[model samples]
Target chain A: MKIGIIGGTGDIGKGLSLRISDKHEIILGSREAAKACEAADATVCTLRDRNCTGLCHGASNEEAVRDADIVVISLPFQHVAPTLAGINPTYLENKIVISPVNPMGKKDGYFFFDRPEEGSAALAIQKMLPASAKLVTAFNNIAAHKWTLLDEELDYTVAVCGDDAEAKKVVMQLVSEVSRLQAVDAGPLAVAGIVESITPLVLNIAKFNGLKDVGVHFG
Target chain B: MKIGIIGGTGDIGKGLSLRISDKHEIILGSREAAKACEAADATVCTLRDRNCTGLCHGASNEEAVRDADIVVISLPFQHVAPTLAGINPTYLENKIVISPVNPMGKKDGYFFFDRPEEGSAALAIQKMLPASAKLVTAFNNIAAHKWTLLDEELDYTVAVCGDDAEAKKVVMQLVSEVSRLQAVDAGPLAVAGIVESITPLVLNIAKFNGLKDVGVHFG
Candidate 1:
């Protein structure tokens, strides 16, 4: 599978590239194409040092979106609209889009869900994309810092929510391919707020409990 | 400790009566005193059949509240207002009150969080009680049906949230005493909405995935 990651120099993008590039082609996209290339090179070098082979390349966000089967918006929730606006809308049409963005804010040493006017980050992002684009919510609840720790296994439950059944299945398959990560179908797009809100909940849990990198599991 | 369940004929109340009555005195309270007594009797009989000793009794909601160190409001969200109104306000003063209530509804066969105007059920209930009453949220995300299945262990994470630090600690201790349940301090009472919303999310997950009684764990 060809996976394109917008804001590909970010922690989650770099982590995903290193973990999955061995089996899939990764296009790391950034506002500056040179920075994306640098990140892609770093990912390749890290994998090679471990005696592993990986395929990764870097490009502008628009170029990445134009050439991939799946496009992952790895940008923060607030940056999603402006970033997507700069890219041509035609590139995203009929392609599977993944949203790992979570809107949250910390106050008085505690985190709270800063929901957008559309109820959740996913719902708002859906409005920014073409109507044909298949938007799926996954990886939103995982601790952001944990994604870059390649030595650790991500054994957490990812709740996949989307309106399209086929697109959701594809995203669920991608989620399961990650290290020990189990994906469960968490109903349709309207349920995204619950999944997105869990990010801040886990953040607060980790903060109050003196724990690090907390994630969720469903049983 | 003397623990009183306000809606003692409910599933969660009966489950708690059966599970912890051996260690603490359980006063099961209901609007219909006879129903509470019948449920308390059933719990005692079940425990006796398993060669377990339990201490439990039944009374009116007001009488139960007047005589307990800890009070659990196990009623549904809609019933909470009327039930609490029927009880004397003085009975709840300066006591540790636990709200396991989750406000939710199903639409087109999918469950969504039906948040009240006060933001969450716990927050809404906090408004109805005296200023000295310590309101803590626990058991919000557990599957209600699973509570009565005595043979199965509830190996789930219970996120306890409250503003009162000491009262929150007491509730967390109580939660840990249950069957293999881990209690995590999930910040202040303001964060209760996130915890309560998980109930509907899990319900939708179970329904969409064709699974049974799904629950959450934070690790």
Candidate 2:
């Protein structure tokens, strides 16, 4: 499968490219095409250094969206609307779009779920896309830093949620393809907020417990 | 410590008595004093069947609250207000109260977090208690039936939440004593909704994924 990641030069984007590039084509995108190219090259170099093979490339955000079978929105909550708007809505129509974006804010040295008026980031993103776009919520709770560590299995559960059953199945299959990552269907898009909200809860858990890179497992 | 469970005839109440009675004195309470006593005796019998000794006793709801150093409100959301109100408020004053109650409702064959107008069951519960009673949220997301299987370790993380730091610490200590249960501070009482919300999310996961006795672990 061809997986395109918007704002893919970030930690999660680079991590995903390195983790799944061997199985799926990874297109890392950025506003600055040159920076995206640099990040993509680094992924290849990092994988190659470990005697691993990966198929990855860089593209402008528009090109990435236009060319992929599935698209991942890996940007911060505030950047999601403007970034997706910059790309033509036609590029995203009828595609399986994955949202790992979590709306979170830190106050008084603690994190809280910055729930949007639309209920969740996925619901908000759904409105921005063409009517046919199948929006799925996934990869929202894994620690971003854990993604690029190939030596360590993800060893976490990914709760996948979407209105379209087919799209959710495809995303869940993709999740299982990653190392030691189990996928569970957490029901439709309406419940996405509960899964997304776990990100902030884990953040707080990590801070107060003096733990690092906290991740979730639903057993 | 002496721990009193308000709804001591329920599954959670019986499970807790069987699990923690060895470490702490377990007081099982119900509206019917005789039934609570019968349940407590049953807990002792169940533990003894496995050659495990547990200290458990039964009492009326009022006696349970009046006698214990710590209290566990193991009732459903709807029953909480009346149950707590029937017990003298003075008996609950300054006691550390644990709430495992999740306000959940099923709709169209799926369960959802029936979020109260007070935002969460915990917040609504907090309003019902006396001013000095320290309300802490724990064990909200664990699989209920898993608690009784002593042969199988309850390997899950419990997210403990509360406003009172001392009470939270006490509760966290007790959680660690459970079979392979790790406790993490998930910040103040305000964030209890997120912790409470995972119950419904896990319920959905279990139903949609064809699984049984689903539990959570924040690793």
Candidate 3:
């Protein structure tokens, strides 16, 4: 399947591209096509180091999602609504949209975030996007560093949720293909609030202490 | 100095008592005196098993503070104000009172917490205590399991705050003597909100993922 990663110049966008580039055609997309080109070139260089081969191209966000079956929005939580609002709703119809954004605020060496009443970021995105777009929440709890280093078999669980069961199943299949990681079906999109809030906690643990490459595991 | 732990039957109380009993006159105090005695006896047995000569005794909260030079409150954040309110202000005056509590709320297999507008649980206690009473905030960010294990020499930092500089200095001294741990001067009582909020993050990391036994280590 052709996967389009919007905001592809970012750590998350590049990291996700690196993880799945071998099995799928990955396109790195950004507001500026030149920035996306730079990111894709950098990822290609890194992947070449491992003797892996696949296609990872860069283009404008609109151009990237035009021909893709699955679109991953790897932008920060604050950027999601505005970024999606700019895109034509007709083009987004019938495509699987994945959101991994989280809300976080820091002040005076302490950090906290305000969670939406609906309980998760994925649900929030589901509410914002066109009804034709299927929304799935995943990767909010995983560290960006660990996601980039796909070679390591870490004991981590990614909690995935969406209102559409089929959409979650497709994302889960994609997550399983990433590595030895398991994606848990946590329930509907409303549960995304809890999943989104968990990221702040992980970030706090690493910030205050010497914890590195942290990952969440669930039964 | 004769030191007392207000919530002496709980994990933090027993851990602190075990760490400090060797060098100080340690006593356990709680609302239920008999329960305090049982906890002290168990702590002694655990100390003996570890081949330590540390001794701990038990008493009522009222009697515990009546003569002690230092008193530590390890109750949950919700109970901190009332716990100190129940103590005699006259006894607390001119004596050091330490509090270490964090507020945490759980939902959907994930843990998150609400920040009290007053800031942290420690600041709340400081405000609730009599003005003449010396109140210090410490131990809100340390992992209870690492603290309970007396011989593990790991480099970890504890954020400490108080309105009184002298009282904070004394509490820092006690913290150093008890666990031989590094205590970072976080700031005045106002920053207690920031320090206390770190708990939910740590709890979320510990509860949600593969990062167990993870404690904060500030550089």
Candidate 4:
């Protein structure tokens, strides 16, 4: 599968590229194509250090979306609307767009879910895309630093939610292919807020308990 | 410590009585004192079968609150308001009250968080309590059936949240005393919705993935 990750210069994008590029073609995209290319090269180099081959390429965000079977919007919550607005909507039409975005804010040295008026980030993002776009919410609760730690297994349960059944199944399968990740169908997009909120909960737990990079497991 | 359970005839109240009565006196309260007494007898008998001593007693809901240092409201979300209304507010004043209630509803064969207008059950229940009553949320995501199964160890992470730091600390310590249950401070009552919402998410995960009694572990 050709996976396009917008804002692919970040830690999550880099980590995904490193872990998944060996099995799937990764189109790492950024606002600045040159920076994405540099990050892609770094991903390839890092994988090659372990005597592994990484099939990763860099492109402009629009170009990346234009050429992939699935799209991953790996940008921060605040950056999502502006970035998606810049992309041509036709590119996302009928495409499986995965949102790993979590809307969160910190207060009094603790983090809280910055719930959008639309209920959740996924619901708000759904309104911004084409009607035919299959928006699936996955990978929302993984700790940011844990993604880049290639030596550690990505052992976690991913709660996936989407309106489209086929799209959800495809994303769940893709998620299971990652390092020790088990994906469970968490129902429709209407309830995606519950899954998205877990991100901030884990972050707060890590901070208050003096733990590092907390992740969730649904067993 | 004298621990009081408001809806003591249910699975959660029974489980708590069985699990913690050896260490603390458990006052299991129900709308019908007779039913609570029967349930308490059952709990004592169950513990005795395992060669353990159980200091559990039964009382009316109001009597339970009047007699305990800490109170656990184990009632369903819809029943909480009416039940609390029936009890005199004076009994709950200056008490450490715990809410394990998760407001959830099922639709299309999947469960979703039915958020109360006050945001979460904790916040909503807070309004119904006396100003001096210290409200804390803990054990919101435990699988209900797992609680009654004496052979199984509850090796799960419990996210506890509250406004009063001292009350939150006491609740966390209580949570840690449960079987292999580690408690993490999840912040103030404002974000308890995020923690409460996980109950339905886990139910959906268990149903959709063909798993049984899904539980969460934040690592």
Give the number of the best model, judged by lDDT.
4
Per-residue lDDT tens digits for candidate 1, residues A8-58, read 999878888988998889999999999999999999999999999899999
DockQ, every prediction: 0.91, 0.87, 0.08, 0.89
TM-score of each: 0.98, 0.97, 0.69, 0.98
By lDDT: ranked, best first: 4, 1, 2, 3
Give the worst 10-residue stretch by lDDT in candidate 2 chain A. A144-153
- Candidate 2's TM-score: 0.97
**What tens-digit string does per-residue lDDT give for candidate 3 at A1-219?**
988888888776777678778888888889999999988888889889889876888988887788688998988778888888877777788899888888766766655555554545676777877888988888777777676776676456667767688988999998888767677665556546656765665566466446675556542
lDDT per residue as tens, model 1, B33-97: 89889999999999999999899999999888999999999988999999899889999999999
Candidate 4 lDDT over residue span B1-219, tens digit each:
999999988987888888989988999999999999999999999988899998999999999999999999999999999999999999999999999999999988888899999999999999999999999999999999899998999999999999999999999999998889999999899999999999999998888889998999999
lDDT of 2 at B24: 96
What candidate 4 gets wrong by more than 4 Å, as runs, is none
What's chain A's TM-score in each predicted model? 0.98, 0.98, 0.93, 0.99
lDDT per residue (tens digit) for residues B69-101 in model 2:
999999999999999889999999999999999
Docking class of 4: high
DockQ of 4: 0.89
The C-alpha lDDT values of all candidates are 0.93, 0.92, 0.74, 0.93
The alpha-carbon RMSD over the true interface for every model, in angstroms, is 0.6, 0.6, 7.8, 0.7
lDDT by residue (tens digit), candidate 2, A1-219 = 999999999877888898999999999999998999999999999999999989999999999999999999999999999998899999998999999989999988788889899888989999999999999999999998888877888989999999899999999999998888899999989889999999999999999999998999998
lDDT of 3 at A100: 82
**Tens digits of per-residue lDDT for model 4 on A1-219?**
999999988877898899999899999999999999999999999988999998999999998899889999999889999999999999999999999999999988888899999999999999999999999999999999888999999999999999999999999999998999999899899899999999999988988889998999999
